[model samples]
Target: MAGPQRNNHKRPFGNSQKRTFGNSQKRSFGNSRHDQTNKKPKHGRQQMREIKRMGRRHQNEEAKEDFPDFPENDEGYESGDNIGEEPSGAMSLENNPRQAYDALMVLLDNGKDEKKTTKKSEKNTAKVQVIDGNIPGNEDEETEYGIEDIDEDEESVKKEDEEDQNDLSEDEEDEEDDEASSDPFEYHFANPQESILENFEQQVSKDSTLKWQSTKTSTSDKQYMAIGQSAPIEEQLSKGKQNIRLDGNLEQFKIKSRMNIPFDDANITNSQKLILDSVFKYKDVVFPYQHYKDESSIRDLYAAHAVNHIYKTRDRILKNNLKLSTYKEALEQGKASVEDEPELRDQSFNRPKVLILLPTRQACFAVGEKIIEISGLQTVENKKRFYAQYYSDDKVPEYKSNDFKYLFDGNSNDFFCLGMKFTRKTLKFYSAFNQSDIILASPLGLKAILEKKEKNKNNKDFLSSIEVFVVDQANSLQYQNWGNVSYILKHLNTIPENYSEDLDFSRIRMWAINNQFKYLRQNLVFGKFSTPEMNNLIGNKHSLNLSGKVKFKRNFTSDESGIGQIVFKLRQVFNRFECELPVNDPNARFNYFKTNIVPFLKEQSDDKEGGGALVYLPDYSDYLRVKNYLRYETSVNFCSLDEYSSQSKLTKYRDGFAKGKYKVMLYTERLHHYNRFEIKGVRNVVFYKCPSDETYYSEILLRFLGDSMMRDVIKDINLSVVKIMYSKWDANLLEKIVGTQRVPVLCFGSNEIYEFK
Candidate 1:
């Protein structure tokens, strides 16, 4: 039978080969021959077998659901494979031998009648296991043969968990339902709670509408009762009326007082009363000076000026057919471009400082104004400008201890001291007051405290720190005065009781040596002079000693001319002074010397434009150029209008009287910044100097003084010309060179000349 079976299997004519059990051999469960052959190679088959064995080891582990589809497939069998294919195929027997053998065993164990079908079913079971464990669903197939059955088990488990959860939830729900339905009223009735009793009373009051009580009186008693009850009430009412009348009287009195007017025998209008009330209510509120002046009755003097500003703005709007708001806005926007006003000079403020010695209160105020003005000056305007303000105790009005303190911070970094040539009496008084309680009460304003700050560290903070000495008892007088800073000065016993040889008290001698000339001089001292060692130290520190940047003229040889004496004096008087001006350029050096240094130097040369013989007016133009170079007014736009006019237009003109010559022609220096005093109708250029100081003063009502030749020469010019001089004021020399006129001379330091004429 086996031989015949083999022969029949090999032959196509055999019954087994020819016959089919429901087309079992021909049906492939839709899998093609190519698919089965390519299913797994020998190495892949071994890997798969190992994978299967490992999987069998974890069979007892709960079957995890298919991982959510990730779009990747690892199984050898791809999509479109028919599941009906059995292990009878040679490819399957090679891929998974164990699975094939199991299928064969199942077929063999079963009777021959079911052998073919049983083998197919076993193969299908193997495929299903791989699919369940590793493979994802077939998107085209929709449903698998055993997946529904597996899902049924999952559903039953899920249902069991949900039923258990429902049981717990039902119990909790039953308890909550009972608690919510419990009778709160029963607990209230069980105990006599105070809140509960109150609730009952409140409820009764809310619900009941009928009255609970009533009272009646006889006719005779009613009449007596009315009289007794109403009498006191009427009296009290009368008292209240009287009190209201008194209050009105008091209010009226207050209104009159606040208005600064007496209401006695005067008719007070309702409007005036209302105004008085409003003013009095907030009278204690502090306001700015401008606001205070506005609220007071004194601002009417400038009504016309204010009206002019308004009229100008209104005219702009009417001419432009624009809104008042728009015109005002434009005016405000344009204000920064206007030229600065000279009148604004009066409103200036100075850096907070202790006022040591000043000429007068008016002078102090003037200095304060100057300081404030300089403080607000444009950086370009401030270049090469040094301003000083000095005040004497005499200038200060009589006041309490804290009065001066109010002028400065208690711990201010700014200090004022005895200037270069202060009177001895003034110096001593200031030095004594500097150490007094009135000045020392607040450390804030003290020079010592100010010196601690970075900005003021190098400034002279002590009287002993100054190199120049003030003359004491030069024209000594025992004039005793009280109620000024002198009041505190008198109490100080710091002055020496006995004279010493080392201490110098030759005030008159030094004064005569410094100024050996006959002339009335306005006292003013500026800049510094240094001793030889001090000069060398500063020069070395600045690298100026070794530098070849500056070359002094060789005319003043061997220290014989007055130039050497001036240099020696300068070196002796000042220490550690640094030059901010450029000394390398001849013109610049000459200008610096003429404006600052030459003023102090003794007359040395008569030659024109050499050895300080002729002074050069600092061209404000150069300063403007430098200022422009320094980017002081970066926002200003400058345009040359030479095509149509010789003038140049500047969007803004930074102020401070400055002029300079380009080559030979003098030109006004524009700030390249907005002006504060400029109005549309007013000329930007004003007060061009007249020919002579006398003529100039005659025109502007200003005091004039200077050499007649220089004055006469500059009189006709429309530009403000500042004269430069290097000679010490001497009456004989003045009459010989210029005129016999007694000119008002402004002296700077010991040897410098500065005259407005």
Candidate 2:
């Protein structure tokens, strides 16, 4: 019996070729087996096969129910071919080979169909879970399948991962671009000309008041009137013809209405008005006679001057930028040509233009407060942090003198530096130096930064464009470190290095480009008293202000000098030394002291009645040289004291010298300046050089020689002798210590020595 009328049909597996299954070969539980008379069934095996077929049939029925829309005969088999029929007999493989082969093919088809049904069910379930916002687990399916199915799944998963990574990288790149664009330092300027033009346009559009329309006459058009004379009033009165008429001419010297003084007219004293006027004119000014009472007014005046300068500079640049922008816009619109473009060169190498050198943090705070007041800004960006750093609530000590109390009050901590940026409505403190409009720093602070840059061979570009330089409390700086201030001045207004990309070259001023900024820069120095150092600094080549310079003159009489303050009746001797060249003055003075004064001091130390000589040297270098000479070259028992001497060493040396253990004591003026030690048991006093601060000279004599305790112990104040050494270079110091009239006789007289009692 030929395999009962075979029904031919084809079914597709994955992507491979299709396979044909006849009705006798259909792999379903309900399919009927062919009736084979020549075949015999194995009863035990047939029973197990029947049970497995039944299980598969049940699973297919459930799959059909879950997806009722799926076609029942989609696998190319008749629906009736596998429904409601049982096997008639089991075919024996040894008796009927064709029948057994058909059975094996039927099993393979059934396995493929079951896999397809299960996959469809699982895929549909996953779709439902995803639509419900439930993520599927990463577990692999255990169902056996062809190799093609596994490869397809892996490719799909890899493509999804690649897409996810690309999306994440794109997002990160976008965030970085935004950050780079927002940060001014990191932002790369593609077209600086256009960028600055736009910036200027925005500034003007936001604040209409920035564009000033004034009818006041320009300073250039006004007649130049001498505000005040530098000569002493007595001398000016002596020459009656040269005396300035003060009748109605005072109005000409009055501050111009257009000068924009921040304080009220009544608040400013009459004495400060002329100084303010001179400063407003951008002239170099030296007010060495400034008193503590005048500090506030001086600070206010300079703050206003600095603010006005910044305003004018900003206005000029913005106005020029607007003009350039308009011209370019017109050209783009075909209404103007290249020749019609405006010339707008008004920038410098960097933005900082005002430099305020203060001695201490307290002074910086005062000046910064005045600047903020003058700016009329309601908000300061870092005001809280700035106050915490510069302001102090510490109680001041009860000093013996009011001057000392005032000088030491508040946060006197030095080594501070800060940069300020000004805007239309606000002021920002602690800005980067390169981006700041003003710099407030101590000399030491600036020196430290300069030294760091020097090691790297980098130029100080921030200081290259300074236009207004103010040094307040300059005398105080002399006490701290004058070399720091000198170093700062030497590096000002120099050409920058490797900073070309940071600036708009087309808009740089011709003067700045040619390194002629020093000529236009204004130098203002204020102090309590004048010194030779201050005079030399102001008169030096660095202070070449094109607007002219003025200095206040002070004259002194014998009674007004510090020498007259000495209480003890003792003989005072002045010795003059000659030096041919100014550069060789140090060596000449050292030699003269070594040859002439050292022997006198040695003899005094050897005398039992004379006691130890207290030798005072002003310059630290001189102190060091004298110290080394006395310690190594001389056999005299000596003790040295300086600013660097610690408390233990100071105590030990003071005790040793007072008890006559040491025959000589070498003292430095700086040590006395910082700590006014009232040393006991001092007899002969010798000055290696006149002190820069004349007060120190009187203080030492009064405290050491006129001490009541020492007087009672010694009982012979007249035996104490004071000797001083000087030179033509010390003329300024000598004039301040001994009256101005006496300086002429002492420095220029034929006598090399003068005696006074």
The lDDT per prediction is 0.20, 0.57
Among the numbered candidates, top lDDT falls to 2
Model 2 agreement with the true structure over 261-291: per-residue lDDT tens digits: 5566556654366466557655667775434
Candidate 1's C-alpha runs over 4 A off are 1-447, 452-757
| Cα lDDT, model 1, residue 653 | 15
Give the worst 10-residue stretch by lDDT in candidate 1: 473-482
Judge candidate 1 against the unseen true structure and give its global Cα lDDT, from 0 to 1: 0.20
- Local lDDT at 171 for model 2: 40
TM-score of candidate 2 to 2 decimals: 0.63
Query: Candidate 1: deviation at residue 499, Å?
Result: 47
TM-score of every candidate relative to the true structure: 0.13, 0.63
Angstrom error at residue 38, model 1 = 99
